[model samples]
Target chain A: MMENEVDGLDKRKAYILATVVYEYIATGEPVGSQALTQKYNLGVSSATVRNEMADLEAGGYLEQPHTSAGRVPSDAGYRTYVDALMSPEELGADERRRIRDEMRDARAQLDEIVEQSSRLLGRLAGNLAFVTKPQSDTQSFRYVQLIWIAERSGIAIIVTSLGVASQSLFELRNDLSPDDLTRLSNALNATFAGRLLRDCDDRSLTALTKSCGFGDDMAAAVRAAFIGARTQEQPGISASGAQHLLDQPEFRDVRKLRSILRILEEQRTLYDLVADAFDSPTASVKIGHELGSEELADLSLVTVPYRFGERAVGMLSILGPRRMPYARLLALASGTAETLSERLHDVEVK
Target chain B: MMENEVDGLDKRKAYILATVVYEYIATGEPVGSQALTQKYNLGVSSATVRNEMADLEAGGYLEQPHTSAGRVPSDAGYRTYVDALMSPEELGADERRRIRDEMRDARAQLDEIVEQSSRLLGRLAGNLAFVTKPQSDTQSFRYVQLIWIAERSGIAIIVTSLGVASQSLFELRNDLSPDDLTRLSNALNATFAGRLLRDCDDRSLTALTKSCGFGDDMAAAVRAAFIGARTQEQPGISASGAQHLLDQPEFRDVRKLRSILRILEEQRTLYDLVADAFDSPTASVKIGHELGSEELADLSLVTVPYRFGERAVGMLSILGPRRMPYARLLALASGTAETLSERLHDVEVK
Candidate 1:
């Protein structure tokens, strides 16, 4: 139980909490007061440190997993330390260079970028890395095409400024000849080119058909095809390096491992869990318990959005046990986002 | 330890081996002679069955996991039972109908077929179900289009009779207008339509440029774009329902789970492991030792090639514990393969 009206941490209490969290992350063991005092200069004795640890535990900064065990950082403890005590570690020069080079190689194949980014980030952070493909909700339209396939059905292709083409099969109320599809394709392209893609909605699809002197069939096909393409072409999330979790002692229990692995398999759950990455520009950490889920009480996620120009297009994130090297993993994520964004600018049309 | 030189099983011994394998799979424990006789109707006396069990153990068909424990089937035992004794179980009518209807709903879009097939098959089989995208080595080309994007580059589009389109950004040797691109696209379509897609190779790509009275730049773009699209568009394997393995006792050890999952994530390893699915027209089972890998010594794979019309276009498989119900899974695979092939024929082009 935590006291809601507790005062903020004093200087000595803050130092002890930081040292305890760091020690626990390194050893995967609860940190005792004696160990913290002996390992670092806290300017105090073990008895005095023990008293401070008890007070911190009551305030919900630390937790004793077992009655006899030493204290470890609670989720609240981790949150405060991340916000105040932890200093971001600078990534190695070689690591940052490799991220930049590999991302540049991935280039315009957005699918490859998602797969490769997860792999690189997973290996670098030594945790499960999650990446959502870079796509902007406010993308601008470049062109639209309708190709005749049969008597009344055709394929609608929409090209976006993001250098992607979304295509799907469509049906018309009346049979349209190849010449008619060609003419309609040209008219649609002229109307929507260089405009925000969201501006071309279902209403415009129907309104354009009548205004362009076409029948209701054209509107039916255009609306159906455009909506279908948008839904099917939405970018997906990739979770990589699950094997990395095998080494963590916390996941030795197969039940615990199953819950986390099950979450990884559920794409919608992962997308919702990491959706906060898109809420801000800088990297943010989500620790266990703070996520409001029982299964994920021992896990942590660090998410940062990668931008294309001024628009935040996608996210790069890492998920691991709550006892993680937060300072290092945060640095890795922010550095990767920056590198991926810079590399995207090199692609000609982006 | 196992012995290689042995004669085939006689009637009584075969019955004993089959029953033991069944009991072990269900109970997840060694099949003691006493327990087998009590649970099953072995006509002979308990002492007589025990004597046969000792003989079978000496012949290497079975082995005792511990000195004090009863016997379990060896890999060789499983092989002989699968090859000679097991009878394939028929899939339930409701299950078969579900597979057929769901596959029909996934027609036209090959990616959706792959994803949905894995999910459905994995649930039905209760194991890690793997499905490779359906594509034929001798698929016929339907049409080609070159759309101008900028001064020297455009997008290459190849539509196949499989109702699938492969597209990639391409570069040309010189600037070509929308009219020039239309002419070149027509020429290429006339040369390759309704012919085996394999007919279009690197050399033919260049030769067609000369024959069409187009510059070498056209040949350069065609070859690069076609090869790039083919490589990027190849159907990948989807390993789904990994969570289904949680109920099995064999994977209680995290090490085993890690090894198998690491294999699943490595697309190349999985592709190689199930490559034999393309070798024959029938469903085949590869037992533990038959795979010849140390990491997978306790696992088995069942592979079946799903067809389109008369040609084998893709594979459906299940990777699970060695002690599995071979008869039922084999029926499931063959049934799924037939249904997917039939559904593919509903698409007009095929």
Candidate 2:
């Protein structure tokens, strides 16, 4: 790795900077030059160590929470360390086995798997974690059941191939009975059972259901509800391990904890966040101000997209204070993404 | 309303105690005798107020946070005030209208109505709030759809009349095609469209499906799954507005806030708490130690069971610090409960 990224710091100096970052994350305290020299095999005198720390601070990679205190890594410092100098810490074998086994053991429903993923990731990472349900753009119909309600209304419950349900209520164009609805439903299901949800465009749906004895009004209303549910709905997120944040030193201040919790509760915000992270095949790291949301300015997020088929449809994330063990957490996030992808693949085959 | 409940404290003395409790709730501070006499027209002198406060403290109705501090209401004090001396604060017409309108506007799904109720109550009550999904012990089947999967397994998706879903996976007794499952499903629905779910005991289920061309194994497995889902499943809860606790003065302590959040996350604990509160027709108040959970020793919970037809099946609750305004929150809890009950009624008729 080319280590001379921060100003005039050479490879040795960058190594010193990474050690400070790692130590601060471990102890939740600043790393002084004297303590650093004594604790790590830096092979340098205290005087020389002090001079390098001062330079690192001047270069904006290190900062002091208090004027007299030793240095902690700034956001820039964390970024550079994660990018160039640091090698990811190995995720434990037991943790990996547990993640795979629990996800495999989850119920066949997509909702159950997603919920278990969030709870497991949160416990493994020791902070808040969340997973978004896969986008339905490419999902095909597993089954559809149409039931006629009172008046001219009907309900259509569509189960996706991945075991998720999308249901909508709509007004029927004709006076349909339970028996008539059942016949029409069976015909519709036979034709579109394995077809892509998006394949039911207005023109094709009209042509297709015309043979099943439904008019333009009936077809249009039903298509509107089905297409609207498939396209307009952003996947909902499941969150877990918020109580873990209480033990973090930075979140001991109740205001910071509240701000983060408030942001997590907003569904639109979480949707936007995971959407932005879904394209990255590996961990996408956003630290402090780089997160853009003011409520998240004191925290960092690491996300990785879990795939279905070839599509990167959903993402899982870990949230922690800025002084987190980024190397291990980044590894864990990507690892979980792999596990979730495998589990989702089995969901279709199951 | 009783003349007195605490020792020999009479009508005049009880009114003085109630006044102190209200004043403390408003200011979040101890009510000094002089301050109380000056602010409220008690028709008595400062000397009388001071003497009465001393007697209330001695009689266990109030306590001093500090020796020299004025007086704050104890749990016993709050109980007496809510039970006898206090008149419930009038919930405004606008507040009642808002609750009704929001609940009425919820989509025709039991789950959506319950979730919306929790968010609305949490905002209106300005604390943590939750709503339990109505129990399915008495729910009747709206519709059931069966689908065949690979390797002799099938799924049963049952929808209750109130628009809640219960699904289960079971091993098939024979090699069933999708058409066979659908035909059998229709036959079953024809016979028992709106029957109570509990009517299908193991013995009756085997006998009924024997003539439908499926073996006892399939019938028994399917019955076990449906019955397990309907009977053993404690209804899941939806909670909202936990961030509101951060602003409460008593929760300003980080430890207190953590304890309450921890308790709120335990689904079983919440299930038990709501179950205990479900039989009461009015607002059920459990203060401090009455909550019976050590983590909730500093908190108070107010619950009111919402009804389905004539049976009490679900409850709504507010959790706040022990020093909450019981008079207003109690009215709001019961008010929200009424709004939710009406909303469920519409779900069925829709």
Candidate 3:
């Protein structure tokens, strides 16, 4: 279809293709030339519209489910409509206000912000939505604390620059008094305060501890704590509103539903998919077969990267049937990502 | 239907009801008497089975989608089948091995354990599954540490008795060196150690700090750190396999799908629902209307509480259509919960 594409469609053919795609998205049914001419003021007679529809079919831009039925947009047809005819839909004032309020409330913590953003996106787009927290490997150390809980056990708490925290309990080879533990913590923080936790090396940690007059036992404890914090699993990925997929007529078959469920259950695949979308500076819409999975062939993914400062830290996305409101979803994804980035900056400042 | 209950059905009626429910669950189609006699060794003629089915419908145990169609199990019919006829389905050795292996690997952390459990449950049941991490309020303090990070900022690290660690950065009102912060941390830990963080009163903390020879300025910092640690929000709730809901025939309508997506997006409602399921000691099967939501009347929830030691701290559940295989799901939920509990205990012990 790509090789057989006709370049530079005439104004009438483009108008007819856009009208057919819009109508199919609104009503999960194919559009006929007669209905398009009657419903839309295309400034053409039914006969002229019929000839354009036939031309669209010949160009592989439209497909007919049956000989007697109307025409539906092919993958190429949707691609053309998204690429040229559609304008980004502006969100209503009330919706903008609601999104702003939700983002503000969620700005207090990283987890809440991610969860809230996913929920709000799902609600606005009426599709399954997901957001990934910033990967820990990309985050710099904001603070690290080791607190002795038992005679031989202590907890290591690590907070990243992104304000995300993680903790783990470790067994100590030797017991250290509160004063000694405090000194060890201060020395460790002074060494790696602004560096990414992933970049902290064992030799530097040991050398820093010894230079600070800590014994071998304290160095081992510090090393264990640093290793625990650095080796912690990746930041979480959360998804919501999967039931939205059930509304699509294409998902009426149980097999399709099962395949989608399998994909959702496999977080690694979803994370990779969202991460790949960050290659684009704006919202990236992967329509139909472009999503690179046979199971997702009937679906479209609209993704936009949310950032911390200029660094693209994470992503938010909406997954729906290929017959989706691409312009509106793209606008929503871009707008929400911008709001979320601003809110995160505000949180960091406070 | 409850009031119209006919107690102590004859052996033949009981068999017919079980067969109808099982067949409906398997094929997702209404079961006619002729099909029932053809499929099962009922040892009766089709005419005899037809009469029994009519009686079952009159007794409110079955329903007909259409006059000419076969009968399907009503809510009351499912309730009867679950209570009286179904036996727990035993998982094969391979499944048990897979669950055990997954849980063993996940036992190192609270978040990993919850995520793994939800994924395992969803995969085994082929339904939407969720697990909530233990709430912070319910956790007792195991350790506390205060480390000064800057002239006006320090990080407070708190460890719960369950080995879950949380950290938050607090602003210091006055400068405290490494030694003074150590004394303050020790005083705070001695006062609140082994006690619920929520029970630490402001007056007690101030007095404890003063008695330990700390000035009013130092006392304020200690109080601030303790309050910050105690006030952290509840642990997160995670869900997986929500796309599984689309596989159900009952969700063919977009309206039904939208309502469910809305519910899933509202985390508070989902949290409350999972929390309520902890009231039971075993796997709870809340069928249809028993779930207490009109929108969820077509669904069933199979929930089991996972414990840390003797405390029931979290829950795992599978959500599916009401026609779900109750016996198999109940067995899977209980088995997974038991495996999770044992794994958590092993982690704590090590």
Better of 1 and 3 by DockQ: 1
Tens digit of per-residue lDDT, candidate 2, span B224-310: 656855774678788888999998888777877777766666677888877877666667888888888787887888898888878
Q: TM-score for each prediction?
A: 0.94, 0.93, 0.85
Q: Could you tell me the C-alpha RMSD of candidate 3 in Å?
A: 4.7
Model 2 clashing residue pairs (backbone): none
Model 1 stretches with alpha carbons more than 4 Å out: A1-7, A104-108, A345-350, B1-7, B101-108, B136-138, B232-234, B345-350
**Deviation of model 1 at A156, angstroms:** 1.7
lDDT (10s digit) by residue, model 1, range B1-350:
11232247777888898889888878889988889999999888888889999999999999998887989999989988788777768888998898888877774566666777787788788988898876544567776777777778777777776656666677767777876776777788778777767667889878987787878878888887666545544467877878777768888877888888788778878888777667777888898977778888888999999877677878899988998888888888778877867766554352
What TM-score would chain B of candidate 1 score versus the native chain B? 0.93
Q: TM-score of the B chain in model 3?
A: 0.87
lDDT of 3 by residue, A119-235 (tens): 888877888888887766767776767665556766667777776666656665776664565566777777788887778778888898888776776667667766666664544
Candidate 3: lDDT of B342? 76
Q: What digit string (tens of lDDT, one per residue) describes model 1 on residues A1-350?
A: 11232238887788788889889999998988888889989889999999999999998999999887899999999988888887769888998888888776774665666787788888888899988876544566776777777778777777677656666667777777877877887788778777766677889878887787778878887887666545544457877888898889998777777787778766778888877667787788899977669999999988988887788878898999999999999888888878877766544242
**Clashes per candidate (backbone, < 3 Å):** 0, 0, 0
Tell me the lDDT of model 2 at A37: 91
Ranking by TM-score: 1, 2, 3
